[model samples]
Target chain A: MLAGGHGNSNPNTNYLKSRGLWVAYSIGMLVLHLILLSIPPLSIPMAWTLTNQVHNAITFIVLHILKGVPWIPTDQGATSLLTHWEQIDEGRQFTKTRKFLTASPVLLFFLTCFYTVYEPHHFVANFLSVCLVTLPKLPLFHKVRLFGINKY
Target chain B: MDILEPMYTLVFTELVPSFHVHLQVLLGLLVLWVLFKKSEKPGRPGKAGKSELDIINDWKPEPLVTPVPAKHRGLNAPVTKNQIAQHITVNGVKCLNFATNNYLALVNQQEIDDVAVAAIRKYGVGSCGPRGFFGTVDVHLELEEKLAQFMRTEAAVVYSYGFSTIASAIPAYAKRGDICFVDEAVNFSIQQGLVASRSHIKYFKHNDMMHLEQLLSEQAVLDRKNPKKAAKTRKFLIVEGLYNKTGEMCPLPEIVDLKNRHKVRLFIDESISFGTLGDTGRGITEYYNIPIEEIDLVMSSMEGSLGSIGGFCVGTTFVVEHQVLSGLGYCFSASLPPLLTVGATAALNLMDGNPDLVKELNEKCDQLHRLLHKSETLARYFRISGCRLSPVKHLFPLELKSGTENELQKIVDLCLQDGVALAVPAFQLNDVKFQTPSIRLTVNSKLEAQDMSKCLSTLEKTVIATFKPTSTS
Candidate 1:
């Protein structure tokens, strides 16, 4: 029920590990950036920064903060203790989805850096957001909760 | 100090007030309406309706299921290409099946088949409707009567599917707001019942009486706190007579004592134990020498030891009668085919007429247990877990690894090649999954005594070959 359980959360979502997921994720990120860009007040750099922050915030909550599932989890409480990150790839380290999730945030960070430049504010915010999301995804933090937070 | 005071006044008066532009507009509109158009009706023309429509459009329904990844369970899984096998023969292989719960070796009986075929020809293939409707065939009544007589109960209700019998019966009596203390390791069917009942389910640690007692005492405290509401909440203690998951027997005598002390009605799912336990094959009560009348309700699937399809629940006339009209599986779902009911009766009769069949099964269980426990090499890698003289047994891997199932599958496949079908998950699992695996072994009375030893030696050799113990000191 904890870190040691299997299946890809659902049979229909078997595409989570498919190669097209990377494409879909990139497209979603691009669409998010474009939507932010459409805001009249936001500059190109600000839009990229906002996109990075929004992406990281969502991934942080979904992949790490929310333990267990929110819907009718057919597998009973088998995933009661696992976050979506831990649930994916059945808790095996260095799997495809884990690598993609870790890499996506860093990629967004670099993309934001390229657009925002080293202006202290945007650079720092994007860097921090990427770090918040990507750090927990490192193999070092597989099941670790540093200050006894959310262990249950 | 002067500059800060002025800044605070400026921000509060100017900046904060400007943030509420919509509020200002609404207030101005209200004043204008009050002054210039006092008699106008107050309902907004279209704004609220438009926003409501936007909100309705924005609402997204959640996916029907959230895939919570569950793992492989180690049961006596008869391996085919992948699907679970039937009791008679697994995946077209005529092997000594020590996988399914064919305890009395009644599955292969000619008499049962003869009765089943004759009845099938007479009644045709299906009952064609739910039991409550026109599906109550004459054989259905006969089988129910036979089951009641066999169990020494006042009456019984037969369900179309064995899995749903208890699943449906449980919800019939134990509805929302009821309290049920359940064993955590009871099979999926009982778990389904617990979930469907929407009851306050307190799961005691599997087969731990102290844990159950602690839960009961906690409930007592609650009941003491709210005696009025407590009186309305029915409390049930549910346990399996023989747990199919662990191949272990419940401490029935202790459970009975606890239930009595806690003022809880007891429900036992004897799916795996009904025909295998007692000398006379009357299940856990008979085996423990407890009177059948002492138990409030009894649920069992005939799929296992009865060597037939469907399931039954037996108790006093009052308890059993309630299920006939209210049990979801019995009332709404189609009844068991007449032929299956007929065949089950024949199988039960065979068990009733010859008690030796059950006695032999008990002996086989003991033999298997003793062999596994005493096997020096087998002991290191796997510790046997299950009740002695209970036909269901488990070999839990001492050091569970990622490849544990594969290793066990290899042993099972090897055994199958040697004409003994041992059950393990030759499970074709995806790349990302983990679960503790064990080898489940079932003992049948039909297995040859010499073949038992031969199977044991084969298991040892295969296990020894499959797993090269690293720390072989």
Candidate 2:
């Protein structure tokens, strides 16, 4: 509703497209990093360095485009919503175990990368094994299960 | 095998092929461009020639309007100093002082002066910062502890100014969404406190218990409609021990009963009543025999009875602690001067040593009240109001006239001319409620039987001359 577009256009569509772009970019970068790790000639440390630089560059470009395009959701609306959510959440208490559970997926992904660098392995097999274990725990998939498509 | 060997080898040798790294960087840049173009797919087809900067530069905001100052009636003469007991010099004329609040006549005590002089020689003058900073000194803490012990509260906190004590203490507990039920005829300081709290304020008629109950009942109905909000909203009842404007004692016993029945916190401001009421001058709570713990907060100004500057709030340890961090005046304003604090300490000690001074002051209040009541001329024109034991008394005109205030001001000036001083109530132009225009007389222990008689006779002659009946058929 705040994007300054035609009245007939669905505001939800803009929200969903903006959210979907983030999800797609995160997934694409993860797969590209794994592919780079599979090249036998590239050392593990060099591959990791390249992955981090690429990730920063892609994030900068995506955020710049999202801010300039009028049809995409503005940063102001997201910030307001996040602030409202935080105010509501401040009154409720959450357990330590629940917090740890929410953060486990990111932790697991970093552990798998460390293990692969520490011990030489078949790169493709190790990458596939890590993906199978980490994909379900990704926050994007959990959000989909909890809120469904319309909420995005 | 060594850590230094690995660091040297890494710095000397190229870790990855330069061509491959450049290719990856270019690929990331190309991917970003593609994503940006895709995002633009949903935007409008055409582009404007001017950039967004041009549009922003052309924008203008609305202008602000300046406020006009309110017109005021200027005073005929300004008071100069406390020349002697029960007298002050106004416009270079010595008049019997009935305007000051020095109820115990301790303003110019020799002991207090000696203590103040000694403190100045030791601690110098100002504290130069807020309480939490480097402002607090040994005397400030001693005074706070003494006040707490004097009031029989668990702890107490002192502020730099009298007006800001209540103003800061109210908002320290009550916040934006809270509800405060206030007396309609409270002083300007209490009104300022209510404004700063930003709470939902409902005013009851002055000292009207039935009207206050009606408002409480109405609030109950509204709370029933929104139980969630009701659960979160805190309710408070604020009143003064002896109202500064009317000089009447608040019905504290009835107020405490209502507070219990309605489950509301009670806050009492005893700025005028402290050191001027009760047998030993413990204030309204002692007068009514109410326990100190029953009231949530008790605030008073040292300017009135202590014969010094600053104010204080005495309460339980928990309630008093919150003010250190939350009270705006205490946290931000410069601390009270060490000399004044020591002077107040000496005054409190004198009060503790000589409880007879309070008794003498109480007798003076009664004597003055009796004298004013028995005056035939005053009785014919005005209604004498306020408790018999209150040092402050108010005289309201029985009939209203178009030039009633002008007539009252003329009477006050005549009293000054006759070597007696009387005060006319001054109200802010934009105040929400207007009090009746009246003359206020402050009684002090220093006035003798003859002085009281002389003051009454002066007022009588002035009133008779000003309001003589017109010749009738």
Using lDDT, give the best candidate's number. 1
Cα lDDT tens digits, model 2, B304-337, are 8888989999999999988887788998899999
**Can you tell me which runs of candidate 2 are displaced by over 4 Å?**
A1-152, B1-76, B82-85, B469-473
Model 1 chain B worst lDDT run, 10 consecutive residues? B426-435
The per-candidate TM-score of the B chain, in the order shown, comes to: 0.80, 0.84
* Colliding pairs, model 1: A9-B67
lDDT of 2 at B272: 86
Q: Write the per-residue lDDT of candidate 1 for residues B280-338, one digit (tens) a residue.
A: 89999999999888789999999988888999999999988977756778877888999
DockQ winner: 2
Number of colliding residue pairs in each model: 1, 0
What local lDDT score does residue B71 receive in model 1, on the 0 to 100 scale? Answer: 44
**Local accuracy by lDDT, each model:** 0.77, 0.74
Task: Estimate, for each residue in A60-109, the C-alpha lDDT of model 1 and write its tens digit.
Answer: 99889887666434443456567778767556555556556666676677
How far does residue B109 in candidate 2 sit from its true spot (Å)?
0.5
DockQ of 2: 0.04
